[model samples]
Target: MRSLTEEEIISHIPELSNVTLRKITKGYSFDLKYVTEWNGKNVLLRLYDLDLSERVQEKVEKMEAFKKLGVRCQDVYAFGEVPEENFCYTIFSFLEGEDGEAALANLTTEEQCAAGYEAGLDLNHMHELRIEASMKEHMAFIQEKFEKAVERYSRLDQQIPYGRKIIDYVRNNIRLIGESRLVFAHHDFHAGNLIISQKKYAGVIDFNRCGVNTAYSEFDKLELFSSRLSIAFSKGVIQGYFNNRVPELFWKIRSVHMAQLLIYHMNWVTDYFPKDLPQAKDAIQYVWEMYEGFHRTIPKWYEERQA
Candidate 1:
């Protein structure tokens, strides 16, 4: 990640009067800076990679749309393209809240349920936002991604049969999901993205991948978050968002999304993990569980979608 001199960041956004840069982290595509402004407000200045021009634009637009839909997120103070470095960046008001995961660990189940439900409510509102355009409108970008993923998985499946099952699941589902109602969705809505303050939901962050997409894609993420915590937590999240019931088709869409995550994990394990490590076997085992779950539930999912 390129370090933006305090001078460059301050030059781009004039609102930071008497700002002081406090910290910067590495190992990410973007640069994160915690700054203290002259006005006594804490703010975060996010500068994207030069290669992420399109993603930055999409994020800016999607954040505006989500705010219009009443989805809680960091308030954008100012954002636009910076000509000097040819990068897009945004300045946002600092939001202070414990991550939902940390909060979950500290709170009782009842409190966890409440926070999860609140997150769900916000997600529900987000999914209700009408998108005048279809995701296919970005076919040149999305279609090629899937095509390459499928081809890569085919080669990997020859080495580990689990990869084939995941490939098949995604092939069958991504197309069906495209046919779903295109609503604004936070593709990454895990506990990490949620913030809780004063024992209640405060905000959600990281809208970098937010867009008009399938409701199912979003649900899959929620499902994974729920699984990571507890069944009760998951139920709380589902009930909070769907009024105690999520449509079956929601799960079907989730199945496809989960399969995608699994494939990504497989690649990570393959490339990063030692070949004989137990970690590799565990990762593959998880994929099998996801496959079995989807297979057993697809008929019910179809019935729900039909209804």
Candidate 2:
């Protein structure tokens, strides 16, 4: 899709008239985003293809829900579709700060952990907005995804190391899928999606990927992304999420989830995101070593830190 001009934006949202719009090109989402000053405050403008109107509406609702729950995220100022333009738009209060992934490396270990702790607390609040899916329905949804992942992995030309073992481990522990309680999740909560200001987590962004899922499943990105960036911060997220006394069952469920990711995510990246294949492989290896080839539930990073 062609980029939306500044005049077009103003024409669609008259409130943004006379403001300067600077295009933001830092994310993977297909939506066109721009930042500008509106009424003495920075605001974000996102334009989406008309076909994505429903999804855009869902994202806006989730953002509103998170705001009402006191989670640090974007606040919607306006949202609507421009039928003539064949696009939908949303205006949100812009979160100001450096991306957490880049900023964490410059922070002290304690600071990184503290930022992660705050992020975890915010995530806990988000989970309080429960979805109405039954346990049986949720389990079926997870199981179906797992089966599809397994089938996709089976078709891969080159599978990940310990692929069969990971598949077997997940299948053996399949009953754990029923133990999870479904809740609204950020779905892409990771250091990269976080905003850090002065060595602290300022807020989270990109709720476009939010959805209802098992609460423990929400930590998948921590294992796959955050830990690789800062183990201390990753540990802090788990610590704050569980109020510092980690549950044994959490470790068990997390292990199964990570195992499934080793099979499913690897195939996914290989197929659609080949550039991320190496990172995905590295994450798989890290998980295998951390869990001692699935012999343990708690990872060495969290265990050593506790010691």
Candidate 3:
């Protein structure tokens, strides 16, 4: 996670040779983000270890895929390794907007939901890139995760809210989860990674962790992160994705997916992010309340608003 020198970066990305280079603070990943003028416009230069060329190439292709699918994102201009450094860099069209998470807090309930809907529209477009993977493969991966959750559930020092019920729901509904379409998920599609310009979803950022997974799986992160910021936005995500016709089966499948994740959530937060544990715990409780003790399928916000 070391920062590259201005001279080293200039040598690699000549476009930034004369532009003002300023390091941008990062939240989670160790990847370095630099803000500078490219062609007289503010742009972001993201650099990461190029130890695995294939992985880096895959990410480049994924970012490009968004453009083909008509999803607005930090348009990637160039991606390749530097001449003398063991690092790869990507130059992006720095979006002009506020952090989507922060922007949601200032909006009215209706405004927040509209923003969520806009996100869903873009997300639906992003899912258009169909990845070729068998349902069996996804099922196997979920099965492996479920087995690990079961083992961890036994060893958890503190009980998750209604832990046993949620576990049972997962076990009972595991079969339904095996069948899903493979799509490239934003991986981190919550409020944190979105850009809100003038109360609208301007674009998405942080595709470093994007991967091919069941489309329904993307909602899990929203359930964990974005929903904590605003439930109106959370409900909008689902409704807008489905175009106001959310299916009965989607809710069932969503509940099952969330239940499985909740199994290991506490230990994961405490073990990995001890400082954020209290907030994470509160978020989990809010989730518990939202799902009505994991008894209801549709989250309360969406359900109560249903006509």
RMSD of each: 5.3, 2.1, 2.7
Compose the digit string of candidate 1's lDDT tens values, residues 133-204: 756764445556777766665665324555666677677666656656667678777777788898887888
Query: For model 2, how does the per-residue alpha-carbon lDDT over 172-286 read when each residue is reduced to its tens digit?
Result: 9977967878887788888888899978889999887777788998898888788878888888888878888887899899899888878877877888788877777888898
lDDT of each: 0.65, 0.85, 0.79
Residue pairs of candidate 3 with colliding backbone atoms? none
TM-score of each: 0.79, 0.92, 0.89
Poorly placed runs, candidate 3 (over 4 Å): 1-3, 149-164, 304-307
lDDT of 1: 0.65
Poorest lDDT segment (10 consecutive residues) of candidate 3: 298-307
Top TM-score model:
2
TM-score of 3: 0.89
Model 1, runs deviating above 4 Å:
24-35, 50-55, 135-144, 154-161, 172-175, 268-284, 290-293, 298-307
Candidate with more favorable, higher TM-score: 1 or 2: 2
**How big is the positional error of residue 89 in model 1, measured in Å on the Cα after superposition?**
1.9
